[model samples]
Target: MAFDTKLKQWTSLGLGTVLMTGALAGCGEATKPADTPAAAEVSETEANSHAGGDHHGAEADAAAPATEAGEGEGGVTIEAAYTDPVVYKSAIAIAAAHVLAARDAYAEGKTEAAAEMFAHPVSEVLFDMEPVFASQGVEDFTGLFSDTSAAVFAGESQEQINARTDEILAALDKAAESAPETDMSDAMVSASVASDQIERASDMYVLSIDSDFYETYLDGYGFYKAAELTFSQNEAAIEAENANAASAIRSALALLAEAYPTALRPDSLDADASALAVAASEVQLELSQ
Candidate 1:
């Protein structure tokens, strides 16, 4: 069987019950309007710094109105809003960082470290955003985050961990549902979706590198390893300001592009790889100038 098919089967078996519940709850509801305005613009590097991924471009404007400014005891003006896109964006960024750190730790065979990293976002970051969710009228938001954090650190089986992760994502979707209808809300929802995608993609990438899977599918493993090596070399070349680095980077990306047809990848993996390739090409162009 193809690797994607096997992956789907494995995931379905592991998450069948949770998936059923999510489907029943209408978890697939569309959060953004078809005509939503462009999101607040940020450079690719800035976005990566915030989210620790290759996500770029803006989908909808996330600027919330600063209403009811008042002077504080120290004569400092306090601009407050019941809904702020900044809060949502910050939460998403922290979540992404947590997932990335956890993946790296897991890949390094530090299971305890990975678990701690996985638990941090829910306990620290998402817990801190409880008030933001409350302001948007998302009931039980704090409880959900707390429960997910507990489950993550409980030393559960991989299947159980996957289920808990799904629950947390569903809760995030629910919070998005409660957000006030506005450009800021749309942007927040989009950001949440993007973060979720990045986390899922990272998980699948880690899985693909597992020793058993790599042994079973040498072609895919070899392709991915080669691509990673080339990409790293390109980075080093760029850092050294080599005149031929741009061409080398382009060649590396082209080699990575060949994996799409030769390897069996999940949809999320394919999408992320394509995005990275495009981003690398853009970087190569910039270096050539």
Candidate 2:
């Protein structure tokens, strides 16, 4: 099985889960309409950063209705509502479709076509986003696929894959729940090690592609090895650890974001290049730390 395909499926699920939860107030409730036109424009990313940590589950409780819109002293309790499930699910489905399409192409002896599908826009996006993700290392990268209790990328067959993908969509159909803000201790160490390691692997992969795909493949495995270790090791213990890492990572991400466009200009990479670059940077930092 192609590793990238599995990785993207899980990552998307995790991202989707976090995003949905952060948008609504109170568990599992239908969101109240925003009081003003200004309130409606808040970005999901900005909203989640403000939501605290208690609500990070892969799925939120379905029966709970969101609280009425009110101005709390600290901030307004805003509700999250979406027009259609099709929008988000369709985007993720495109990834699945690419994987299945690639598989079909490979089976039909159109290896180049299959590889191109897997390696294009999606790959580029992952590469671009790598620097931000590198903090969690392989554990974050691989965990994208391994959340068996949550997403279905763990399934061994196409049927299972489709089922899991659908399950993720169904979960998205419920009202978006908001998580409390999370502490950054665990994320920091994981991010550092994963970042360093992935960067090394990416550099190696780029350099050795012509000489040794096997070695490059091994490098990929090695990078994930570090990621898994960092991710698993820091899991529950993070709350007690240092909170400084998040700020540092945010700084690093800001820096990385600025660097992305310039890096891709000379290479003429497709969309996936940015994501892949960022992922590699994330691993590089983790391994180095």
For model 2, residues 105-138, the per-residue Cα lDDT tens digits are 3444433333333322122123222232233232
Off by over 4 Å in 1: 1-81, 84-90, 96-109, 143-154, 184-289
Candidate 2 root-mean-square deviation in Å: 21.3
lDDT score of residue 234 within candidate 1: 38
Q: Candidates' TM-scores?
A: 0.36, 0.23
For model 1, what is the C-alpha lDDT against the true structure? 0.35
Which 10 consecutive positions of candidate 2 have the poorest summed lDDT? 52-61
Per-residue lDDT tens digits for candidate 1, residues 1-289, read: 4323432342334221222211110000121232332122222232222222212112100111221233111111112223444335434443544444443334444343344344334333343344555566666533333344345445556566556555655655565455445464342333233323233233223333332322112222222333343234335434445434444444544544443333333233333544544544444354435
Q: Per-residue lDDT for 42 in model 1?
A: 22
Clashes of 2: 66
Best by lDDT: 1
